[model samples]
Target chain A: MSADQEQRTIRCLVAKVGLDGHDRGAHVISRAFRDAGFEVIYSGLHRAPEEIVQATVQEDVDVLGISILSGAHDTLVPEIIDGLEEYDAFEDTLILVGGIIPDDDEAELKELGVSEVFGPGASMEQMVEYVRENVPEKE
Target chain B: MSDLIDELLAGKHRALARVITKIEDRRSGHRDLVSQLHQHTGNADVIGVTGSPGSGKSTLVDKMAATYRDRGLTVGVIAIDPSSPFTGGAVLGDRIRMGSNIGDMDVFFRSMSARGSLGGLSTATTDAVKALDAFGKDKIIIETVGAGQNEIDIVKTADTVMVLVPPGSGDDVQMLKAGILEIGDIFVVNKADLDGANRTVQELREMLDYSDGAILQSSGHHGAGSMEGTDGLQIEAESEGWDPEIIETIAQRGEGVDEVLDTLDSHATYLDDSGERERQARTRYAEEIRTLVREDVNDLMAEELDHRGGMDAYLDDVVTRETDPYTVADELVGPLADCVRDRRKE
Candidate 1:
């Protein structure tokens, strides 16, 4: 979040990572995030490790939301977090992953430092509020 | 050389890149730039590449462009990356795969975001192609915007539309959505090095066997399987590269691109001899754009009527059974017309 948004609220970056090209869910959720008043930067489909990180840095976003349905979550998710950490966005940006997961990968994904994994039919309003409540209120 | 046009016409790579940015941003001066460049079009052969996600579209387009450049043809590529439906911005990552061609003087490749367009293209894509067209490229290849079947809109703009089916996908049969199938002039089964390459070809042949259109199947990965899908829709057995006319190769290796190019030229000639090419292009936007404009105007009227608690009140009245939606809409249209008339009176 920039100082302007942080003065009152939070800013978020939502991206589609890896080859998971299903974007309708990501797009709708990002719009929900935006309507919730969080400044949202959505990186369109097929983002590489470096590209997502560059967007996170440039946007100064407070939260990172990733939507992947390509079954490449295990490979792409960790690499993106690592890139965020390298870019110093890890501590500042809260990471969220949403997509069609088999339910078995949820625990491992969270253990690898993802904050939340909302699955299919997840509530967009709840996700918006979840981000709002989680990001610390700045002085 | 209206800055970008001058650069594009001069065959400058960066200028083409920057103009794509301007057009994507919907900047003010773009209309004039494209208007001037319009005269430069009709020279390049437009090829569209589209397929399922992770189908290696960017890599294939990169290799194809390089191959065209090698053939002493100036290449123009419009790589359509998907855009964030929420924020309306694109990742434009084809540059990662197309490393050298980014700045090649002879090859101009521009990566564009689909910009919330459901149809695998931006509103500016046709104009962008026109810009590249006017730049005098002999061949222009458009990579699909990673949106799968919806990206079929490329058929309206491209001279030869290549429907890429990656090997082992098992999803190739699903790509025959009404819009996409009719548009494909040639079919490329990319990633041929994979195990299910032959099976995929067989499945596609079987599916297209009874269909009316022409179909060709070639691998874009390793140079293998040149069998044309139109030959036998149902291949009982996979024979040697018997026809040699169909098997093309190695999008990753840029192998057999010459063959792909030759096929595209032949197909274009066929379309010309049959006279289906211009007939299609003329009515391309007429039917589609007519409905699109009506939709926009309907949406405009809706927004205009919703400004002052009008929608909420109408809904409340309808919910209360005091008024049907048709009556409310009728009541609203009169005021809406008056509002428009009053504005005109101003």
Candidate 2:
């Protein structure tokens, strides 16, 4: 994986997983990522676990960012991570989560293979940098 | 729209209900479905109804819902009950009084607990509304568990907000929370069947007078003949044991729902037809976006800062009075606020 390969168009798919419909941030992030030159595909409100995994595979995304505000993150995120692992996309895709996460759950999410867990108030600058620096590029 | 959404868009009842349920379910892969729905939204009107617990909002909401249903319109209802602190979700579906229209297959009612959300709505209520909006419900009604004035959060997402006030709830102090008055698109003197309905109406009228004469009154219960119009139309007639024509109803009995519906239509029409309505709607949309953005950004920062022990540092600073929350906000994203506002205007 190299920068030349990285420029193979950093494709990112932003999805609001589970019952959360508060997509203002998701929409904002999509535009920001688009502005930063990634091919962005946004999955809007009320998405299920399987739909997200299928979209991640179908889109062939380098990173999958899921936003959950429904307060069911503890149960929901694991389902997606486990599902992705089961589907074999878990290793290839960088999973990031944002929104109303309780303070106690960060280590658990990270242990579950989530690349980054962002809470509210993080700058778009930080987000773009984190994703760009971490996600692997094709050979 | 996708095939499933196409079916929902064409007014398939089962599809509509199922998709909304998916939108509200925490484990469902609701993202793609929502993405599909986003393309099909903007067809429905969202009306938010909220008030105090004893204000008879659900009943009034029920009546209002029925009125819309009878006119051959599809209705989507989201009922928010108080969440017990222990469980962090709605423990009771006590809003069963509004069942008159809930029985209709065309009417979809989903109940939720507030789940410690300070603003009176559960975390998922807005998402549920979006689900209803995407499902092509002609009208969406949100019945909140009346957290007094603070319940105004519903106004953040709704096009029109109806505030319910029951009779004999005490003076003006008891009728509304201090700052909550501004959130109401219209005011109702609900439970017109109770004593002192006139006094309550009078108090509301007095409050409205201060605002250049802008509030309307109605009974808050659902079913037949529940809310009759007062003779003055501008003020209560004061000779009321539930004015049969003006406001009459046993919500459980389903009386006077037709008139309440008529009042809602008239108010909505008034709002939509006015220049202020257009301006207000646009402002509301912007606010909705801002609230979501603010919360999302806040949560992200809170988590990151916590991980870095920044919050602990901030707490230490605050204890020593070195930095307040305002100072912290200014220090962190203060410089970026202007840019966000500018972008929002765009």
**Best DockQ among the predictions, by candidate number:** 1
- Expressed as tens digits, the lDDT of each residue in B94-152 for candidate 1 is 55576435335466655555545333143467777887787677888888743544466
Q: How large is the i-RMS for each model, in angstroms?
A: 12.5, 19.4
DockQ of 2: 0.02
Give TM-score values for chain A, per-prediction.
0.88, 0.91
Q: lDDT for model 1, please.
A: 0.64
**Model 1: CAPRI class:** incorrect
DockQ per model, Cα: 0.03, 0.02
Considering only N, C-alpha and C atoms within 3 Å, which residue pairs clash in candidate 1?
A1-A62, B1-B6, B40-B134, B205-B233, B209-B233, B220-B251, B226-B246, B226-B247
Residue-wise C-alpha lDDT for candidate 1, range A1-139, written one tens digit per residue: 0100111325566787777768998778766765565555566667776666655553445678888888888889898888767645577568898887677798899898888899977897889778877884321
Model 2 C-alpha lDDT per residue in residues B282-330, reported as the tens digit of each score: 8766765676566657765666566657767888888899879888767
A79 Cα displacement, candidate 2 (Å): 32
Regions more than 4 Å wrong, model 1: A1-139, B1-15, B28-40, B86-90, B100-102, B117-122, B145-149, B171-180, B213-248, B287-292, B295-303, B306-313, B322-346
